[model samples]
Target: MSQKRLLLWVFHSFTLIAGIQFLQYYIFYNSSYPFPYTANLVNSFGTFYTYLLLLPLVFYSAKSAFSNLENRVQRMLLLVLSGLLVSMLHLFVMHFVNWLQIYQWTEDPFWNSYRFLISKWLHFELIAYFLFVLAWRFLVFEKKGSEASKPEYWTQIKVKEAGLVSFVPVEEIRWIEAYDNYIKVRTKKDKFHLVRMPLREIEAKLDSGHFKRIHRSTIVAIREVVAIHQDNGQYRVLLEDNSTLKLSRTFKKSIEDSIRV
Candidate 1:
């Protein structure tokens, strides 16, 4: 991904988490407690705990939506199921801890009371599950909106008939070598087509997760980078195939930043 996009996704993730907390707090506080301001704050605390405890849910939901789930139904199902499971686990632990307190202190406040614990837990489970659904919807909407807003040039690829040829999958491409007006996409299997597209144009067509510009005429795939070695203060990516590609010092950090592992 471009540096700008990576930063945007990070910001979006935080915003979604905060938004969920606010909305869930509003719903729970209004329904379960009578106080306006104070109950709202308490609800916020609950949502905070929910966010902290359910961090995996947020990550998985994003991963499922972006990388795995192909349909909206599956995405929503995963989000809801994961959300409910995480919430129930938190609720059980909270109630169990409260039970330990009640045994030691001999207090009864319905807040932690066991009289209708099952029903109350179920209620909160529904609420937490709804929060996850809201998050899923938000991500889907954001993706659609982003797609709609992209410039036409980014999605439209120029067609040039290159007589019975095969191209590489965007994922398998490690780098592209640009010479004059033609760029060669290098993959694990072999060097593919020599297209007349500019490196920038081809980069736009490829998946950002797999390809990134490391120099004016070079782009590298993070997955294929086996090692980053320095030679006389210059950086180079040693690939899985034992091939080495030079990384320009100017864009070295940007390339390094995109490597997830």
Candidate 2:
């Protein structure tokens, strides 16, 4: 994530909890609940701050425990394990922070709270982990939907590798080159995939305005082209990845025109 986005997320989360705390105080006071305002807000915000700090732990736990298991049952088990592990770690941190903050880092109080927190909020901690994960997944789905709605000159590509199939967004592809019996697609990230199609056939399907054939064997995403240079006596097309491909004399003008526009 970009630093700007991360900061925005943190600000949003802080405001959300602050708003909730105020609402909770208002409701409790009106309903004759006897909890003191400072105590209530302090505890909730303390938890919120600790949760913010431990968010990385949650992500790391999920990723480390995932194991890439394809089996549905195993995947579910790993997910639950991740949830449990993060919950436990969160519970630990909450106690540690409470000890440092409220208990003044006293040895006895820290040990006492640490020992009994599990019995008190084990289910609540696990539920919080699940809620965070569920919310993250929902945001990711919404993001994908938003990206899908955007106007794109080219559609996705179906790629099969390692006995598994996946779709690569066409906008991510930087260039393509003809390989015997197939075309090699190179993404902006420098990952390559051999697509089972002739260069001429695939070229027809591409958006002419976005992709320009530089050579009989190479076609580049026009937007990714950084510059064109004639080094020595040969024409070359420079791409965003800092690599160059041979530019056929016949297609040089076509690429220049497409990229210019």
Candidate 3:
């Protein structure tokens, strides 16, 4: 993640924990409970601290499991295991905190108090873990949708030729050819423009779905392709303007995959 995004995630996580804890405190304060306000506040803060400490682990495990595991069944199994582990860790911490409180307030044995605490809170802890997993899945879904909706092409490009500089619509470009240290851009209107930039640099800016580099020195717009033919062990791309360009064997499969009949 970028630094800005990391900071945003941290800020949001902290805000969510603090908001939830405050709400818990308010509810407890207004209710007719036997517990003192200090106990309620301490318990709320403990819950907040447990989740805050587990956030990084939860995020990393979810990301790694989804990205590294290709099998759907395996990915799901890993996610479930991670959730259970986190929940168990939370339970342990909560028990430890409760043990400390009991030791300070009463003379009850640590094991007896810990067992009672686990029996009371285990079900709720599991519910929280499930929610955490669901939240991570939602975040992944949102990120994927955001990426899919982004624009895939440049609207226009600036070109200079013959002491004149002008902006050309990217859709009008038919093909590009590498010329020494510069590139030559050809348009559907039979206009030729020269720009003092490397072919690789221009290729990076072009949308992969709309244009493809067929050779080290040539990039063609997919919409301008008329036909692809193989002759004498050589591949050729026929363009809309009755022009044919050699297709490198290295890129033949990619071109074939990108174009549909």
Q: Best lDDT goes to which candidate?
A: 3
**lDDT, candidate 3, 1-261, per-residue tens:** 342464367557766776687677768663775556666666766666777688677777777776688998998888788877787778778767765754556777777776776788777876766665566656564476478778666767898767788999989999999999989899989998888899988888889888999998999999998889998899999998999999999998888888873
lDDT of 1 by residue, 23-136 (tens): 776776666644455445534454345445555565556566656778988877776776666766666665655455343355565454644665667676667556554554
Worst 10 residues of 1 by lDDT: 152-161
* TM-score result, candidate 3: 0.53
lDDT of 2 by residue, 208-250 (tens): 8788889999989999999999999999988877899999999
| Candidate 3 clashes between residue pairs 3 or more apart in a chain or in different chains | none
Which runs of model 2 end up more than 4 angstroms from their true locations? 1-14, 18-42, 60-67, 101-109, 141-261
In the order shown, what is each candidate's alpha-carbon RMSD?
17.3, 14.7, 8.6
Which residue pairs of candidate 1 clash? Answer: none
Q: Which prediction has more favorable lDDT, 2 or 3?
A: 3
CA lDDT of each candidate?
0.64, 0.76, 0.78
- Name the regions of candidate 3 deviating beyond 4 angstroms: 1-119, 122-127, 138-152, 162-164, 230-233
Top candidate by TM-score: 3
lDDT ranking, high to low: 3, 2, 1
